[model samples]
Target: MADELLRASGLESGYGGVQVLWGADIAVAAGETVVLLGANGAGKTTLLRVLMGLMPAWRGTITLDGAAVTHETTDQRVRRGVAYMSELGVFPDMTIADNLRIGSRFAPRAARAAAIDALYARFPDLAGKRRSLAGSLSGGQRKMLGIAKALAGRPRLLVMDEPSAGLSPLYVAEVLAVLGRFRAEGLALLIAEQNVAFLDLADRVCTLERGRTVFTGTTAELHANDALERAYFGLT
Candidate 1:
C-alpha cells in the first residue's frame, strides 16, 4: 500500500480518570475510506479526538506519513495537514463564503478566491448557499460546508465525526454522495458513526468494542454474515 496518511497504535485516551479508548489501532492509507463502527459510548468519537490532537493521548503513538505527531498540538497537526471536520456544522453563523475563507488561512492569499470557486464547482448545492448564512442552510448543506472548509485547508487526512448524523434520508444521500466524490479523488477519511446503513460505502470497516478494535477488514467481511454484523454491533 502507499504511505499511511494516518496511523495510530496502542492509542489510549479518555476524560478525567476514566478511559474511553484503550490500545485502539487503525490506519488509513492514501485514497482509502475507512469506516469506524460502534454503538453509543463505544469511544469512536474519543478516538477521533485523540488522533486529531484535540484530545491528549495518555498512551500510544500517531504517525502521519512516518513522522511522529503524537506529541503535536491540535494547531501543529492542522499545520501538518490533519484537518478534522466535526459533525456539528462548522461556521454556522457566517455566510457560506466567509466560512470557506476562514479555512484558507494557511494558503497564499492569491489562491483563496480560486479555492472557493473550485469548491463551489465541485459542490453546486453549496455554491447556491455561498451568499447565505451557514445557519440557514439545510442540515445536508451545512455538512457540506464543514467538509468544504476542511478541503479548503488542504488536508491529507479528513477525520470526520458522524458526517451523516441527524439528517433526513434524502440529506443523508446527499452527504454520502459528497463523500463518494472525495473518496474517488483520493482523500483519506476516518469517519466515526453509528450509522451502519452507510458503512458499506467505505472501502473498509472496523468495529470497536469498549475501547479496543475487535475487527478490521473490508465491508464484505463485516456484512458477509448477517449474524456477525449483529454480533459485532451489539445487536445480539
Candidate 2:
C-alpha cells in the first residue's frame, strides 16, 4: 500500500444522535480510480462527507499521503491535496471563469492562471461561455464546469459524488470520457456512483451495505460474485 494516496479506516459518523457509518473502510491508491457502489441509504454519501471533512468522524482515521487528517477542516484537507466535487458543487451565481478562479485559489498565484486556462482549453464548451453565469448552463454543462473547477487546484486525489447523476445518456458518456482523460493523466479518483457504466472506468470497486464495507476488490472480482452483484445492483 506504499502507493496509497488516501485511506479511511473504521470510519464512524452521522447526523446528531444518528450513526450512519459503522467501521467502514476504503482506500484509493496513487493514480488509481476506486468506485463506491451500493444501494440507496447504504451510506455512500455519508462516508464521502466524512472523508471530505464536511462532517466530523465520530471515530476513525483518514489519511492523505500517509498523514493523518481525521480532524482536519475541509479547507485544510483541500490544501493537503484533496479536492471534493459534490453532486451540485457549482456556484450558480458565479461566472464560469470566476468559479474556476475560486477553485484554484489554493494553488500558487503564479500557476493559477495557467491552470485555469488549461481547464478552459480542455472544456471548450465552457470556454465559449466563460463570461456567462454558471446558472445559465445546462445541468450537464454545470457538472462539467464543476469538474474543471475541482481540477484547477491540481489536487492529488479528487473525490466525487455521483458525477453522472441526473444527466442524459449523451451527457453521461461525455462525463465519463472526461473522467477517463483525467485518469489517463494520472489523477487519482474516488467516486461514489450508482451507474453500472462506471465499471468500465473503475480500477477497483467497494460495496457498502448499511454503512459498512461489505466488499472491496477488483472490478472483475465484483463481477464474478453473482449474489453480491445482484444484491447491490438490483440485477435479478
Candidate 3:
C-alpha cells in the first residue's frame, strides 16, 4: 500500500537453533498503529527484536519505505528512520536531556537541537526536569524519557515492545495518551503489548499464537471475536 512504512514477510528467527518465529508477516502504515497481542512466551518481544534488527533473521525480508533492510544493522535502521524502545534500559544516572542528546547524535547535526526542543514542547513536564537525573523521575516520567529518547532521532516508524508493561493504571493512561499524540503527528507505530489499554491507540490488532500471526483485523472485529482470541491464548 502507498501508506505502508514497514513490511516484514516470512520472518523466521530463533535463539541457538530454537525456532521461535514461524513465517510471521506484519506491516505498519504511516500514521497507523498496529497492536500486537499475545500471551507470555508468544514471541512478541522476539518479533520486535527482529524487526529492530537487534536479532538476525534466519529467513525473511524487512522493507522500510520501499527499501530492503533485512541485513541492516540496528544503527543503520535507526538512521533510515526506524526507532525502537523497550520498557527497560534507560540510563538512570544521565540527565533526561543528555539521554535524548545521545539519541539525536545519530541524526543530522542540523536537526538535533530542534528535535530536542520540540520534544520539550511536546512534554512540558519533561522540559521542567531536563537537567535532573533521569533516575530521580517517577516511573511514568522515566517511561516518558525513554519515549523521548526514541523521538529524538525523529523516526518515521516506531517499534516498541511493551510500552506499558509494568506501570500503574494512571501511568498507563498517561503513556497511552502520549502514544496517541505520536499517531496524531503522523508517525507509524508497531507496539507489542498484552494490555487492552492499548485498544484506544490501535488502528488494527494482530494476535500471535505459538509464534504465528493468527488474527489481524480492526479493533471492533477483535472485540466481536472473543472466542478467537480465547483459542489463541489457549483459554479453551
Which pairs of residues collide in candidate 1?
none
Model 3: runs farther than 4 Å from truth?
A: 229-236
- Taking all chains together, the TM-score of candidate 2 against the true structure is 0.98
Per-model TM-score on C-alpha atoms: 0.92, 0.98, 0.94
For residue 211, model 1's alpha carbon misses the true position, in angstroms, by 1.3
Per-residue CA lDDT of model 2 for 1-236, tens digit only, reads: 86988999999999999999999999999999999998788999999999999999999899998999998899999998889999897999999999999999899999999999999999999999999999999999999999999999999889999888899989999999999999999999999988888878999999989999989999889978999878756787
Candidate 3 least-lDDT 10 residues? 227-236
lDDT of each: 0.84, 0.92, 0.88
Candidate 1 lDDT for residue 222: 82
Residues 1-236 of candidate 3 have per-residue lDDT tens digits of 66888999989999997999998889988888999998889999999999999999999999988899999998988988888887673689999889899878788999999999999998898899989998999888888988999989999888888988778999999999888888898988899988877878889888888889888898889867879746544454
Best by TM-score: 2
| lDDT, candidate 1, 201-229, per-residue tens | 68888888899998888988886767657
- Candidates, ranked, lDDT: 2, 3, 1
lDDT value for model 3: 0.88
